[model samples]
Target: MPNPAHATGTDLLVLHALRCVGFAGLARVSEAVGLPEPDVESELIDLAVAGLVTRVPGDFGGWGLTEAGRAADAERIRDELDTAGVRTAVTRAYEDFLVLNPELLDLCTAWQMRSVDGVIAPNDHTDPGYDSRVLERFADFHRRADAVCAELSAALLRFQRYRDRLADALARARSGALDYVVDDMGSYHTVWFQLHEDLLATLGIPRH
Candidate 1:
């Protein structure tokens, strides 16, 4: 029998992507769902027409789920999990993710700030040595994280997108676009944070 989770339509994919990622523009939404910009925009319009989603217009604006959309997503995702029979697998991965989550936050903090004389100060990127040290640590953390991501993807293919996006962020960071590590809007930290939200939402778990 075909897995019901794999039967999710594009509407659910895009809608839940917005739910996980929060407010984001076209490109980010497209990147999250592994869809093209034009396709995501079309689905957003459809979702907007149904009142489950809304679009904000401005330099700092993007798409977000409405209250109704949140409720709908909760119900649908639960159905997806139970119908697909992968809840246990997802739950186990979520536990592994919890172990890695704090380390990721620490890395992001190290990238953007630093400890000096017991005071937390913003990192101004003035010291190449300090920056390189943090970057190396992030790479090491990612290697450890890859295992959890792989486990999730093995159960539900949609999760593979997270792995791909995370890798892209690291690649850009390695190529000297250091902002991709944590500063850019869709940086590795940002994407990992969103994935955290996604895993919790999908598992019906509360965020701490």
Candidate 2:
């Protein structure tokens, strides 16, 4: 499939991802864009050559946007929002997204780790009852997330991809792909993270 991030002919998606996530590995970038690692690496190289982004070499380091890249992304994303005439709508949707953000994080945490004996511990999936409860909450969370995605798609068509991706993640989780809940690259938390980035970028809102 063609890259949805580049369908609009702008690198704002990748640039803003770096802006929000700080620095990240190529695997993360590829997961976020639903593209292969090589494709994301190619784009990262081009951005680096243009002095808009930089690659950090270290065990814990990866790619990050330059100051210039951040500025460019802000300008371009703002312009795109204005051009689409969806600033007001997207802003409103973002407010709604914020309300759901904490709960979503809670779900992710519950999925990856469980509260046991008043201490947060990794969920080893030993207790069927606990797993079922978490899965139930996840299903409920998806219902609310659907509304946010709907509002976003209404504002900008490109935002529709998030709805599909998020649903796919949840579906995988339900189908016993436990990693899809959080740990895996295409997990529910990952898709939600990208949607959060998309909302901030579309509204030209800074992540402080």
Candidate 3:
């Protein structure tokens, strides 16, 4: 299927993705926005030229927004929320997300480690029944999470990308790549963190 993101401006996509992800390389930024690296890198260069973002060099180096970029994004995000008049909608969805957040963390922990004889050790996946139970719970959680995504997407088009990414994470997890749940680049937890960041940024709320 053709991507609906084409209608949205790539510049804003790259800029806002930087706002959400923070200090990511070209590849990471591309994954966040579900855009091709060439397209995303082109926009990043344009943003750099405008003094909105800067690149760092090191083993941990990546792209990050400048002070000016953060300020600009704050203003733009506020305007976008007010213009769409969805502050209440988005805020309510955020509340729902918070409730799901802890559950997801617990589910991921269960997937990664198991308790045996009062000892918490890494799950060796030798127990198929245990693993199957965790996957079932994950599937059920994804259903509830998708509902929240739908509400947010109706409020802001950019939010559609999160829904897409989250679905991909869950899909890969179901296909026997368990890392997609919490360990991989596009892991369910990774997308959830970015989505949470996007919500806070859009609402002008500070992280607590």
Report the C-alpha displacement of residue 7, candidate 1, in angstroms.
Answer: 6.0
- Quantify all predictions' global Cα lDDT against the true fold: 0.89, 0.79, 0.88
Report the C-alpha lDDT of model 2 over 1-208, residue by residue, as the tens digit. Answer: 6213223443555676666556789887766656678877888888999898999898988998888898888888788778777788788888999999999998877777887789988888999888889988999989998998887777666677678878998899888898888877678897788788767766766679
Tens digits of per-residue lDDT, candidate 3, 1-208, equal: 6222212467877999999988898899999998999999989989999999999989889999999999988888788777667788889999998899999889989998999999999999899899889989999999999999988887787888999999999899889998898888789988998998998898888997
Better of 1 and 2 by lDDT: 1
The most accurate candidate by lDDT is 1
lDDT of 1 by residue, 1-208 (tens): 6443354689999999999988889998998998899999999999999999998899999999999999999999899888878899999999999999999999888888999899999999999999989889888998988889988887777788889989889989988999899878669998898889999899988866
Clashes of each: 0, 0, 0
Residue 156's lDDT within candidate 2 is: 69
TM-score-based ranking, best first?
1, 3, 2
Model 1 TM-score relative to the real fold:
0.91
Model 3, poorest ten-residue lDDT window? 1-10
